[model samples]
Target chain A: MNFNSAAFLVFLPLVVCLYWLLPFRARKYALLMASWFFYMYWNPLLILLLLASTGIDYLCGLGMDRFDGNPGKRKLLLCVSVCMNLGILFFFKYWDFFGECVSGLMAFCGIPYRVPSLNLILPVGISFYTFQTMSYSIDVYRRKCTPEKDFVYFALFVSYFPQLVAGPIERPGDLLPQLKKEHRWRSEDLKAGVRLLLCGFFRKCVVADTCGIYVNRVFDRLLQANALAVAGAGALFCIQMYCDFAGYSEIAAGSARLMGVRLTRNFDRPYLSQSYGEFFRRWHISLNRWFTQYLYIPLGGSRRGLLIRLRNTVIVFALCGLWHGARWTYVLWGLYAAFFVCLESVLEKPAGKITERLNIPLNNPLVIFTRRLYMFLIFIPAALLFRAGSVQEVGQIIQSLLAADFSLTNALGSLGMTSFSIVSLTLTLCAMARIYDFGLYDLPDNGNRTEEAGRQVSGVLMVLVIALCWLALLATEDAAGFAYFQF
Target chain B: MQEWVVLRHPELVLLYGLALLLCLMEKKWKASRGWLFYASCACAAAASAMLILQGADLREAAAYLTVFLLLMPGVRA
Candidate 1:
């Protein structure tokens, strides 16, 4: 079930309460049971897949440790673990897509050989948990961490309910220790968690879902939609996508925090970044971390010359795109990101030289704002590509975007944004801007100033915001699932 | 002698329970009691804010005060 559903709403609190109520040793079993139930809630049979993967990795980790002296055996176990995880992921997620591609190629050569399209249902969070399990095995193989002796803790690590589905994609070094620790209730943790829960729910239920309605409407019928509508929807989808995924991350971190367990930081207000390089650094921080550590570094990363670095960047991003889904659109989306990121890298020196020659201070507010706007504007096209059903739909969206309608009335009308939506979106967008860009309402930045009053007023404000947002969400009939859940 | 708005928020009983717990834990923890005192005060303020928004009267305010005054034990702790 998604974080948006009522079942999860009930399940999370019960798990948290149960987590704290049980004795330390038994908490793992309860959490494991809850996590399995949470996963199995989606597809009962898929839990076996999760368990089987977990078991393989668990054994692989132990094998790596046992055969530490023998390089061959250790390498063999590592290969087994990585291959097993990637094999299952490939079969479920990409088998049909690849099959179609291969058959088309065969037809082009006048060959009658056909690859059967296995229409397999991708198990929910298979992509996420597999990566997590693989990380565990790889980390153990590298001797960065020891193998988890207890199967229960390892299983809980693999399927921790809060992050079992959508994740910050916890690593063994970070999350496993906390899972094994004894934690009592702390008012601070409770307060912090509740605060995260409030903001997360508000972001997801209100901002993302509300924007999602208009975004989906416009994109679903890109043929009929005007330029203003397609472009506006593209921009809205950017906001919707960020809020949806970031909101999930927040709720994941928050729920985990309730049990006095801290999850890794996933998002860092990516929207406000001044450059593509910085935007990516902040966005999906965990996934990027995984790619950087495992893939990029292994491929010589930026340790080599500029050409190789750029090649590595393309490969990582192309795979990164594929990792999102089996779609060619996603691959293009990844290259789209890689292109801008590479451009920024290549132009970093030249841009600075130009700015210096022109006496343009890069730190100027106007300059910063322009950069932020540029990054966001660049993202809109990529957002279109990411959501499109095919490459052709992307071309349609781009065509519509080019046939621009410059009228304010047409722009507003095309979006069909009601006053309520306009008001709610404006308020939330302003909130995001203030929180991420300006840090006006930020607690961490103005710790001393806000310590007394911010937390106090937040109680009253948060309750109102949460109540209103949830009420609005419940009223909206087209409440969509978290956008990242599909991956 | 005074009124508290917390008791009028019967719908916010969880908030009341949390407020009581925060009050009880005020001095027992290693961190400064001010940490928890502010939490209790926030809870108190939220209850009042919610009650006022709900259009509470003076009698309801008085009942809230009776329930809130029970928090006086936290003064020493």
Candidate 2:
């Protein structure tokens, strides 16, 4: 069930209440059952996959621990677990995409063979849980986290409903230990939890979904749109995506916080980063760290020669893009990001030399702001690449952008928001979102008592305004599912 | 839509006025911002009742206001 839905609104509180009311030993069992119910609420059959992955990893961890002296056997067990998890993911998520690719290759090669697609429905959150479980087995094999001995606790860690579906993909070391502890109800956690939930819902429904109304319209009739419309919609798509995925992450973390379990932070004001390299460090931090630790470090990372580091960066980004979906567009999107990031890294020395020669002050606020804007604008084409249906569609958008019909009225008119009321509503909502994301009106603190109070009060006012706008938005626009749910 | 008309109706004006007053009081009496939370809730609940009496849909401004208050900052703490 979606976190924004009324059903989950009821379910979360009821589950949390029952969890806290139970004793410590029964609490874990209760939480496990609740998590199973939450997962099964989406699809009853997929719960089996969850159980299978959890069981395999749990057993693998135990086996690795038992054969700790035999490095060969430990390595074999880790590989077994990794292969099993990936095998399930491939069957459920990637089988049809693979078949389609092979079929295309066959047709191009003048072969008379056509590969048939099984067209199996992919289980929701397969990629997320698969990566999470693989991390557990790998960590156990590497002697990082002690193997979880308790079956129920381990199961709870794997199926923790909050971050189970779309995650700030938790590591075993971070989350498993918390599963074993007794949590006491705290008012502070509840307050912070509710704050996060409100912020997430406001962003998802009011900002992202409202923007989706226009973005979907423009993309639906790409041929009818001018350059300005496509580019405007491309920028909105970036905002929509960040809000949608980060919205989900915030809600997940907040829900877990209500149960006194703190998940890792996923986003950190990525839009404010002054460079593409800095953007990666802030955006989807958990996944980036995962790639850095498991993939990049294993491939020698930046510690190696420049050629190896560049190769590793490109390979990791390609895999990262492919991890998002089973489409070539996603791969292209990954390559697009890698290109800019690599360019920035390779040109760092020369760019510094040019700035030195020009006598540009690197720490100037205006310069910093300009750099941030440049970094943000760099993502527009990448966003187009990520969201386009096919390579041809991507070409169409780029061609339209190059044609340069940059009229604002023509763009809004094409999206069916030509009327003053609708246009005002869209712009106002977008402004609120920008302010909310960037904190444009933060109360300045001079360390006085009244100023501190004013700061707190201003924050309270911001949430109130966002909440009011969100409610109004719900009355007008239909809330959309998060964009990341597809992956 | 008629929802916008209902939002601007005379009956809802008092609710907004009350919210404004509570907000000002929150600023004046810095030690007692709790009243703003109550005032926000009471205004929403009363507005919802009025809308119900006027034969309007419950999903109008009242419902929105109620949710806004429930999740409004500084309420739980």
Per-candidate TM vs. native? 0.83, 0.86
lDDT (Cα, tens digit) per residue for candidate 2, span A1-487: 8777778889999998898888888998998998899889888998999999999999999999999899999999999999999999988888888888898899899997777788877788888889999999988887899999999999999899999888888999999888787888898777667757766765676567766777888999998899999988888888888888888888898898888888898988898899998999989998898889889999999877778878888999998998998888999999989988889879998999999999999899999999999998999888888889888998889888888999988898766664543644455454444335322122333454533443344344445445544555566665677777678
Expressed as tens digits, the lDDT of each residue in A243-290 for candidate 1 is 889888888888988998888888887878999889988999999999
TM for candidate 1 is 0.83
lDDT for model 1: 0.77
What CAPRI class is candidate 1? Answer: incorrect
lDDT per model vs. reference: 0.77, 0.77
Interface RMSD of every candidate? 13.7, 8.6
Model 2 CA deviation exceeding 4 Å by range: A418-477, B1-77
| Model 2 per-residue lDDT tens digits across residues B15-57 | 7567656645655564453546455555655665566566554
